[model samples]
Every structure is written in C-alpha cells, then in structure tokens.
Target: MIRLPASIRAACVLAVVSALAACANRAPTQFYTLLAPAEATPVPAESGYAIELLPVVVPEQVDVPQLVLRSGSGALQPVDTRRWAAPLGEELRTALSARLSARLGVRDVYRLASPASLPLYRVRVRVGRFDSVPADYALLDAGWSVERRDDRSVRTCDARYREDVGAGIDALVAGHQQALARLADDIAATLRRFDAGGCPDTRT
Candidate 1:
C-alpha cells in the first residue's frame, strides 16, 4: 500500500471538495424548442389529406443538439448551456410536422402503423441552411419534394424563409417557428395545386 503524507492528503481532499462545489454551483442547462402546442385546427374545406413527412436532413454545421448561433462575422457558435429538446434535425421535423399538419389539417403518419387507408403524400425536406442571428433574423433555406403515394407524381422545389427576430432565446425560437409556418403554407399550397397545374415558382 502506498501512503501519502498528511499535507498531500489534505490537499487532495481540498481539491476534490472544490471540484464538487464548482459542479454544484454551475448553472443548469436550459432547453429550447421550435414547437408550439398542437391544437385542433379546422380541416380545410376543399378536402382532407394525410402527409408522411420524412426525417428532415439538417446542415452538418447545425446538426447538433446545441443551438447554433451565427455571429455578425459569419462564424457559427454552439451554445452548450442552451440546447434543443432533441437533435436539431429531429426538432426541425417535429416543428414542421406539427405546423404542416395544422395548416393543412392533415395527419402526419410518418411512423404510424397501418396508414394505408387515407391518401398520403410523402414529403421529404433537406435543409441547406438554418441561420440564427440573435435579435436580427432566423433564416431557413430548404429544398423539399412531395410525391403522391398512389400515382407516384412528384414535385421538387426550393424555398427560403426569413423572419426578423427580437432579443432573447425565446424570440429567436419564435422566429424560427414563423419561418416554419411559412414553409408549411407553401407546402400546403403545393399539395392544393398538385392535381390542377404545374408547380408555382413562389418565393418567401
């Protein structure tokens, strides 16, 4: 057995105590979300539909759980203390799915069992950029494609959505929510016009 001197043992004990105290005093991590509580939205008068929104693919730069903030100098900063409730990609899908379902009054049966009864539109989204400039703007650039399950008709489109933001984390997240809502509106519009005409070059 190796025995330490009294002074060295006391120093080790003090160091351990200090480390524990530091950890205890650290601030708690806070989680943020781009989701609003799902509410019962009135079904569209034209016709009801169902959607299968696939897992959204986020950019590699912001694919982490931490919220990525863009600086004025175009640098990306990941804030560890503030994080998303889930991975950024999954979070994006959840937010978009809820908004889209509400906007179109459709069921999102992405992973639901036995969803063969209703007509389904398989929606896939790939996010090119998700920029968060605190108190400035929240921007989303994405290319999404929609395919009708029955007839295999497909439409691919690219869009950008930017929302001006106020200060604070909640405001930033709210800005993102608005941008997602705009995206959902465009998708709903596309679905509405899928059978009637060609794709519209709508920019947001």
Candidate 2:
C-alpha cells in the first residue's frame, strides 16, 4: 500500500465520520391515514340518484405529504418524521367519500368518475383551513356545494368543525377524523334533502 499524505487521510476520515453522523441523525418517517368509525346502520337500496364526489381542494399552507402543526404564534410547521400515507387532499377526499357513502346508505357514490347517462349530483368541497395544535385541537373550515345534473340547480353549504387533541400525534389525527366525519354527516343530510326535492340550506 502507498503511504498517503496526512491532510488527505484526515479529510477521508472526516468524510466517513460525517456520513455516519448523517445516517444516525436522520429520523425515520412515519406514515398515517384517516379512518372512519364502523357503523351498524344498514345500506339503502337504489336511492335512484347517483352521487359524484369531486377531488377536495385544500389550502396551500397545509396541502403537503407531511403532517402540519400550527404554532402558538400561528406559524405552520411541517413535521418530517410524521407524514400522511398519501397526499393530504387525497386522503381527505377518500375519507369523506367513504363516510358519505356509508351515511347516505348508497352504493352509487363515486370519486373522479361517474356514469354519463345517469342523473348525477356532483359534490365539491373546498377546505379553507385545516390545521391542528398538538395536544390542543384540530380545526376545519370548509365550503361545499351540490349541483343537480338535470335541473342545473345548485345548493351551497359551509361548515366549521373542531375536535380536541388529547395527547400525541395519534390523538391529533383522531381529532381530524372526527371533524371530517361531522362534515360528511352534514353533507349526507343535505344530499338527502336535495333528493327529496327540497331546496338546499346554505347555513351551517
């Protein structure tokens, strides 16, 4: 083996140490998904109206793959270790779809696609704000609309929901799920009213 200069050998050792330090300092990423509670309610047969759930629109501040936490001073911080299993918007959309489908007792609910020939009621949700303070609370402010395909009639609604965060990240996530479940319940009620030919109520 050839003898190396002292400076070069020191540089090589330093590089190896830095690489090891980086690997040791890096945090492992954790993934999470939202889930709805199981219900004992039975599914309704052929509600005669097909429902289409459009992709959810979330605020730019929190529409990320990582979990967002709001600071006491109102700054938003993304946690690198804790992350959403999917994009945050997609997760919310899927959770809402499942909740609405179950609550409405209809199998005709869909996301992104619907039968063209069938009369469809399209539901669109825009989330103005979704954020949580760790161990404090999770808040959601959202506006939604339902439009009738045949009559071209539209009904818009808005809701604000908050759930207390009890302990850790699991509690924060559970709070968000509860808030979303409440939102879905409101939407399902509106759909039922619309199906009954009643005018939409915009009040939350």
Best by lDDT: 1
- Output the lDDT of residue 110, model 1: 84
Instruction: Note the Cα lDDT for every prediction shown.
Output: 0.77, 0.76
Clashing pairs in 1: none
The candidate 2 region of ten consecutive residues with least summed lDDT is 12-21
Q: Which digits, one per residue and each the tens of the lDDT, describe model 1 over residues 38-135?
A: 65677554345688999999899999988777765576767666789999888889988877766776888888853667788899999999998765
TM-score to native of every candidate shown: 0.80, 0.79
- In model 1, state the lDDT of residue 19: 44
Look at candidate 2 and tell me the lDDT of residue 151: 90
Candidate 2 off by > 4 Å: 1-27, 108-117, 195-204
